[model samples]
Structures are given as structure tokens and as C-alpha cells.
Target: MKRVLNLVLQSAKPRTVGSLIFSRNKQKMAVSPSLNSLSKVPKSSSPKPQIFNLLTTTPKTHFKFTPIFKQSTLSLFTAGHANQKPTIKHHSNSSTRCLFTGIVEEMGEVKQLGVADHGGFDLKIHANTVLDGVKLGDSIAVNGACMTVTDFDKRLNEFTIGLSPETLRTTALVELEPGWKVNLERALRSVDRVGGHFMQGHVDGTGEIVGMEMEGDGLWVKIKTEKSLLQFIVPKGSIAIDGTSLTVLNVFDDESCFNIMLVGYTQKHVVLPLKKVGQKVNLEVDVLGKYVERLLGAYKTS
Candidate 1:
């Protein structure tokens, strides 16, 4: 049970100093250096002690020392001492890594060719350009929903997401048929410009497409949902339709119906336009509204 320790001494022509020693009898002892060993050190007349370092082979183990110094003193421990091991703790202020803002960049279709035994649909996403920096195990926002990557094919520039039973129940993806167009967006990166509002890829509710009207070069899509999800919608506020971030142009039907504005560029890139007016679409709202509500409740309680 021996522990290694290093010692540094700054001394001039001065009285002999002692080295730290631990007795097996559970006592601390200070043993001075032998005269023969002290005589080997160079004699100095300076008022301050010259810096010297030593690694001694003491027979005793488990020792700690604090060397005195003219300027400052510090105590250090070698790895040989094993009293406790460091532990990692979870902090509330730490980043919640799974957050995503709905900003669709690509489109793909669910193919029955490579469907897995787990009953998950395969998405043939072409991610070569926008997702060039994407790595395995990263989450992707699919149709305003979050899905984890299960496999990747670098040659084909494709990835697979295995859907659990829980996902099929809550999301509009369950209605996806073969060759159905799907909106795709990678998880928000830290260096991203954040062109859209804060989103978590959480499909709080599903909405049914009521109608689509052409407005100039863009298109306006009307959506109807339950009242439970309607309270979060606001005019000119943010909303993600089929994973594409857009603003709510208007809210009607006691807040159950909302309108989304899709510019010509967005209409060309996203898959939402491919679907008909009677189909259902995944819907997600900005998470900031929920946070504000939570803080307001806390204040009311206080």
C-alpha cells in the first residue's frame, strides 16, 4: 500500500528541513535529511531558497504533503492515491440536445423496397448537398416529426429511420402510402442561421387540409384541427406544416382553422403541395409559447 509523491524545496544556506513520512502505526513523522545527503546540495548565500525538486523512494505508502514556499504554496496529489473516483452529474441548464426547429430542406418518398421487419417505412431522401455534413445517429425532422437515424448508405446518400409503435399513433406519418411525398429537414445545427422560429419537431396535433387557394405566385393552405391545439396558433406567428416552417396568415373557426402561406420557392421544394386538400398534415407550433405559459403559471403561484 505505497503511494508516490513529489516534493519541491527552495532552500539556501539554512537550517535542515524535514521530509514527510507516514508511519504504519498511524502517525505522521517528519524525518530530516541525512548530513551526507544535505552536504551534496550547492551552498547559496541568497536570502531566498533556491528551487529544487526531488522524487524520494520512501518505504511508507499513502502520504500527502504541502511544501512551504517563499512566494506561495500549493498541494498536489499523484494518480497513485485513490481515495475516490470522479462522478458526472446532470445539470438542468445544460443543452437539451434533441431540440429541432422545423425548417425543411429536402423531400423524399417512403419506399416499400427496403421496409424493415419492425414495420418502419423507408425514406429515399437525397441528402447529398444540404446535409453534406450530417453524420450517423443524428435526428431528422420528417413531416414536422422527429425521427432518429438507424442506418446510412454513404454511396447512395440515404438514411433509414425505424419508427416505433408510439410514433405511428401520434403522427400523421401513419397515413403515408407508398410513393407518398414526405418533407425532410435535418436537425438544427448550432451554427445555423436560425431563419425560422424555435421548433422541437414535436407534432402536438394533426391537422386536416381544408382547401388550397392560389394567391399570386404562392399558395395558401387552410388547415383544420381540434380546439386543444388551436389555442397556440396566432396570426402572423410561426407554424410548421408537414415540417416546413411557415407563418400563420389567419386563424378562424374559433381558432380551430389556420392558414399557412407558402411562397413559390417553398411550394416548389416542399412535398406539401403534392398532397390533395382532403389529406391530413403534420402540424407543429413554436415552443416559445409553451415556455411563456409555464413561466406565467410559476409567477401566478408565487
Candidate 2:
């Protein structure tokens, strides 16, 4: 028993310590070339064993270190496309329309109005707050009608808009003359809080201011429009007059007239009350009503 114990203790002693053994079908066990190099590294030079080369002893089996980034990264360091001008794409349909909240930003003065060299009418308006960040081809509502900014002058605080033939035939913008004040509002952005109802700045028609009277600190104004437009005007519905949003108080279908009460704040901000009776004002009814009418018409036709 003592002799057997001594033999077992001798066998337990390690013949090879901290050595990795690799096998191919268990026929022969061999140390990998990279592992052999790691074992050969001086302990004094490196606290731990280090691999000098990633290649293995077996030529058939090659181990290579892949790059952290690929060739696609080369474009990031190149400047070939730096000077290229960016292209702007525009839609040809109604989707191209810009939306507004019917909240007038400021009143702009008609500085100059004349025929443009391009055949349309060019309107130069002197404005202040509305010109901030306004660029060429941007849309601005003039008298509740959406017009594109054809040119601008930051120094003069003025901008020019082109009025097309269709605009002249549809709405009352043609009535604007030099020194006249027009309601101005910028296109709504996604981050902006919607203060009033949605307005497309597309004037459906013009309405005549038939009556105006003072009630308390508010102003009671009545406008008479055509039957075609009066059908869309409803009590408590939203209506934009000259780019200022107002709630409809009463709609007299028999008289083809509707009234709205503008608070003191609204009265001072808008150009509606400043105008006298018999003057035509651009009118845009609630878009929802127009959409409903179209949907019902489709069902009726079917």
C-alpha cells in the first residue's frame, strides 16, 4: 500500500504545466503556433503571455485579424461632394400647399406694386417680424391668401411676392394698392403650437363688410358673402377674414351674412376692422366643411 501511494503521488506531478493541447480527430495532440509564441514571451517583459503574430503553424488554416472599419469609411474622409449644390424637390399636387394657423404674424405695408418682367404682378411689401428666416420661394399669407416670397430685402425689411393671373381672378388681392396694409402670416411649422384653426390661405371668395359696431371692449363685425360661400359658414365655426381667425357667431342664411366678435387684442392686430363697410375682404371658411361637402357629393353621385 505504501509503494502504491508513492507511485500515485509521482504520477500526479505535472509533466507539462499550463500547456494548451489541440487535437485532430484525437490522432495527435499539438500546440498551436500562436499559442507556442505566447508561451515563449518573456514574463519579465510582459506580465502576461502575449501573441506576437496571429498566424497559425498550419498553412491550410490561416487566422487573420479583421479591420474595425471597412472601405466604406473612405468616403467620409473625402471632400469631392463638399461643393455640390443641394437639390430641392417639390410636389406638383395639392401636397405642395403650405398650411397656416390663421394667426396673423404682422401687418405688412404695400410698398410698391407693378407688373413683373415675367408677366405676373410683383408686390413689394414692407414688413418687420415676418421676414425672419424668410427665404426666396417661401410662402407667406398676404391678406389671408398664400403667396410665395419671390425676393426679399432684410435691410429694407421688405419682401416681394408674385401674383399670378389665377390669383387676380379668384380673390381680392388685386384691390391692394401702395401704402395699404395687408395681413401677413408665415407658414406653420411642425414645432409650432397651433393657436387657431387650420387655414390653407386659399381664399374661397371675398365678402363685403356690411356692418361694424362696438360692444364692450370687443368689436362686432358682420360680413355678407355669396350664397355659395355662406353655405359653409356655420355658427361657432372658424372663419378667417383677411388672414385673421375669428369664430362665427351667427349666420343669417336668409340675408347671406355672418357676424364675428373680435376682442380688443384681435381688433388691434388685424386689418379687418380698420377697413370701412362695402370694402371686400378675403374669406376662407373652415376646410372641414368643404371636405364634408365633397364627400357627400361623391355619395350622392354614386
lDDT of all predictions, in order shown?
Answer: 0.70, 0.84
Clashes of each: 0, 0
Candidate 2 residues lying further than 4 Å off, grouped into runs, are 1-95
RMSD of 1: 18.3
- Candidate 2, residue 19: CA error in Å? 83
Per-residue CA lDDT of candidate 2, range 26-113, in tens? 4544444333445763433336654554344333346745443445566786548768877689764231478899888999899988
Report model 2's TM-score to 2 decimal places.
Answer: 0.69
Alpha-carbon shift of residue 3 in model 2 (angstroms): 99
Q: Could you tell me the lDDT of residue 261 within candidate 1?
A: 73
**Highest-scoring model, TM-score:** 2
Model 2: lDDT to the true structure: 0.84
